[model samples]
Target: MIELRSQQGETVDLICRRAYGRETAENLAAVLDLNRGLAALGPVLPTGTLVRLPDPPADPPRVAVVRLWD
Candidate 1:
Protein backbone atom coordinates (compact mmCIF):
# COMPACT_ATOMS: atom_id res chain seq x y z
CA MET A 1 0.00 0.00 0.00
CA ILE A 2 1.13 3.50 -0.79
CA GLU A 3 0.28 6.49 1.37
CA LEU A 4 -0.20 8.85 -1.54
CA ARG A 5 -0.44 12.47 -0.51
CA SER A 6 -2.48 14.58 -2.87
CA GLN A 7 -0.73 17.89 -3.44
CA GLN A 8 -4.11 19.14 -4.55
CA GLY A 9 -7.53 17.96 -3.44
CA GLU A 10 -8.30 15.95 -6.56
CA THR A 11 -11.09 13.42 -7.06
CA VAL A 12 -10.52 9.64 -6.98
CA ASP A 13 -10.26 9.41 -10.75
CA LEU A 14 -7.61 12.08 -10.73
CA ILE A 15 -5.86 10.34 -7.88
CA CYS A 16 -5.62 7.03 -9.75
CA ARG A 17 -4.50 8.80 -12.89
CA ARG A 18 -1.75 10.49 -10.95
CA ALA A 19 -0.67 7.40 -9.05
CA TYR A 20 -1.38 4.31 -11.19
CA GLY A 21 -1.94 6.16 -14.46
CA ARG A 22 -4.85 3.84 -15.14
CA GLU A 23 -8.29 5.01 -16.22
CA THR A 24 -10.04 2.31 -14.20
CA ALA A 25 -10.55 4.10 -10.93
CA GLU A 26 -14.29 3.64 -11.21
CA ASN A 27 -13.87 -0.15 -11.48
CA LEU A 28 -11.70 -0.10 -8.39
CA ALA A 29 -14.28 2.03 -6.59
CA ALA A 30 -17.01 -0.40 -7.55
CA VAL A 31 -15.00 -3.30 -6.16
CA LEU A 32 -14.47 -1.38 -2.94
CA ASP A 33 -18.20 -0.72 -2.73
CA LEU A 34 -19.16 -4.37 -3.09
CA ASN A 35 -16.57 -5.42 -0.50
CA ARG A 36 -18.25 -3.08 1.97
CA GLY A 37 -20.68 -6.01 2.47
CA LEU A 38 -23.15 -5.41 5.27
CA ALA A 39 -23.18 -1.63 5.28
CA ALA A 40 -23.39 0.44 2.14
CA LEU A 41 -21.60 3.75 1.91
CA GLY A 42 -20.72 6.44 -0.58
CA PRO A 43 -17.63 6.86 -2.73
CA VAL A 44 -14.50 5.37 -1.19
CA LEU A 45 -12.03 8.03 -2.10
CA PRO A 46 -13.13 11.61 -1.38
CA THR A 47 -10.74 14.30 -2.51
CA GLY A 48 -7.97 14.42 0.07
CA THR A 49 -9.02 11.38 2.06
CA LEU A 50 -6.18 8.92 2.67
CA VAL A 51 -6.88 5.40 1.45
CA ARG A 52 -5.16 2.03 1.44
CA LEU A 53 -4.52 -0.41 -1.41
CA PRO A 54 -5.04 -3.46 0.80
CA ASP A 55 -2.57 -6.36 0.94
CA PRO A 56 -1.13 -6.84 -2.49
CA PRO A 57 -0.69 -10.45 -3.49
CA ALA A 58 2.68 -12.02 -2.75
CA ASP A 59 3.94 -11.55 -6.26
CA PRO A 60 7.44 -10.57 -7.26
CA PRO A 61 7.95 -6.87 -7.86
CA ARG A 62 7.65 -5.96 -11.52
CA VAL A 63 11.01 -4.22 -11.45
CA ALA A 64 13.18 -5.60 -8.69
CA VAL A 65 16.16 -3.31 -8.71
CA VAL A 66 17.60 -4.37 -5.44
CA ARG A 67 21.19 -3.29 -4.83
CA LEU A 68 23.20 -4.18 -1.77
CA TRP A 69 23.83 -1.27 0.62
CA ASP A 70 27.48 -1.22 -0.32
Candidate 2:
Protein backbone atom coordinates (compact mmCIF):
# COMPACT_ATOMS: atom_id res chain seq x y z
CA MET A 1 0.00 0.00 0.00
CA ILE A 2 1.61 3.21 -1.18
CA GLU A 3 0.46 6.54 0.30
CA LEU A 4 0.77 9.99 -1.24
CA ARG A 5 -0.73 13.42 -0.62
CA SER A 6 -2.37 15.14 -3.57
CA GLN A 7 -1.02 18.46 -4.70
CA GLN A 8 -3.28 21.26 -5.83
CA GLY A 9 -5.04 20.51 -9.13
CA GLU A 10 -3.76 16.95 -9.29
CA THR A 11 -6.06 14.17 -10.44
CA VAL A 12 -5.79 10.44 -9.76
CA ASP A 13 -5.04 9.71 -13.43
CA LEU A 14 -2.18 12.20 -13.50
CA ILE A 15 -0.75 10.98 -10.25
CA CYS A 16 -0.98 7.36 -11.29
CA ARG A 17 0.78 8.03 -14.60
CA ARG A 18 3.54 9.98 -12.91
CA ALA A 19 4.07 7.60 -10.02
CA TYR A 20 3.17 4.20 -11.43
CA GLY A 21 4.00 4.79 -15.10
CA ARG A 22 0.91 3.76 -17.09
CA GLU A 23 -2.64 4.84 -16.13
CA THR A 24 -4.79 2.19 -17.81
CA ALA A 25 -8.46 1.71 -16.94
CA GLU A 26 -7.62 -1.23 -14.65
CA ASN A 27 -4.89 0.72 -12.88
CA LEU A 28 -7.06 3.78 -12.47
CA ALA A 29 -9.92 1.65 -11.21
CA ALA A 30 -7.62 -0.02 -8.68
CA VAL A 31 -6.45 3.31 -7.37
CA LEU A 32 -10.01 4.61 -7.21
CA ASP A 33 -11.10 1.56 -5.31
CA LEU A 34 -8.25 1.89 -2.85
CA ASN A 35 -8.83 5.59 -2.22
CA ARG A 36 -12.63 5.28 -2.04
CA GLY A 37 -14.96 8.31 -2.12
CA LEU A 38 -12.41 10.08 -4.26
CA ALA A 39 -14.38 9.63 -7.45
CA ALA A 40 -17.28 11.51 -5.88
CA LEU A 41 -15.17 14.66 -5.68
CA GLY A 42 -14.77 14.83 -9.46
CA PRO A 43 -11.52 15.72 -11.20
CA VAL A 44 -8.68 17.49 -9.41
CA LEU A 45 -8.44 16.15 -5.93
CA PRO A 46 -8.12 18.57 -3.02
CA THR A 47 -4.65 19.46 -1.80
CA GLY A 48 -3.24 17.48 1.10
CA THR A 49 -5.75 14.74 0.46
CA LEU A 50 -4.36 11.35 1.37
CA VAL A 51 -4.42 9.01 -1.62
CA ARG A 52 -3.65 5.34 -1.28
CA LEU A 53 -2.09 3.49 -4.20
CA PRO A 54 -2.45 -0.19 -4.80
CA ASP A 55 0.53 -2.52 -5.11
CA PRO A 56 2.34 -2.25 -8.41
CA PRO A 57 2.19 -5.06 -10.94
CA ALA A 58 4.86 -7.69 -10.74
CA ASP A 59 7.68 -7.77 -13.26
CA PRO A 60 7.31 -10.12 -16.21
CA PRO A 61 9.04 -13.46 -16.03
CA ARG A 62 12.28 -13.90 -17.93
CA VAL A 63 13.33 -16.94 -19.96
CA ALA A 64 16.74 -18.43 -19.30
CA VAL A 65 18.75 -20.47 -21.78
CA VAL A 66 21.53 -22.96 -20.89
CA ARG A 67 24.10 -23.61 -23.63
CA LEU A 68 26.08 -26.80 -23.69
CA TRP A 69 29.15 -25.09 -25.10
CA ASP A 70 30.47 -21.53 -24.84
TM-score of each: 0.40, 0.77
> Which regions of candidate 2 are displaced past 4 Å?
60-70
lDDT for model 2: 0.84
State residue 61's C-alpha deviation in candidate 2, in Å: 10
Put down candidate 1 lDDT per residue, 20-55, tens digits, no spaces.
645364535643553453113243443455544333
Candidate with top TM-score is: 2
Q: Name the 10 consecutive residues with the lowest summed lDDT in model 2.
A: 54-63
What are the per-residue Cα lDDT tens digits for candidate 2 across 1-70?
8888898999998888767876778879899888779999889888988888887878833559999999
TM-score of 2: 0.77
lDDT of each: 0.48, 0.84
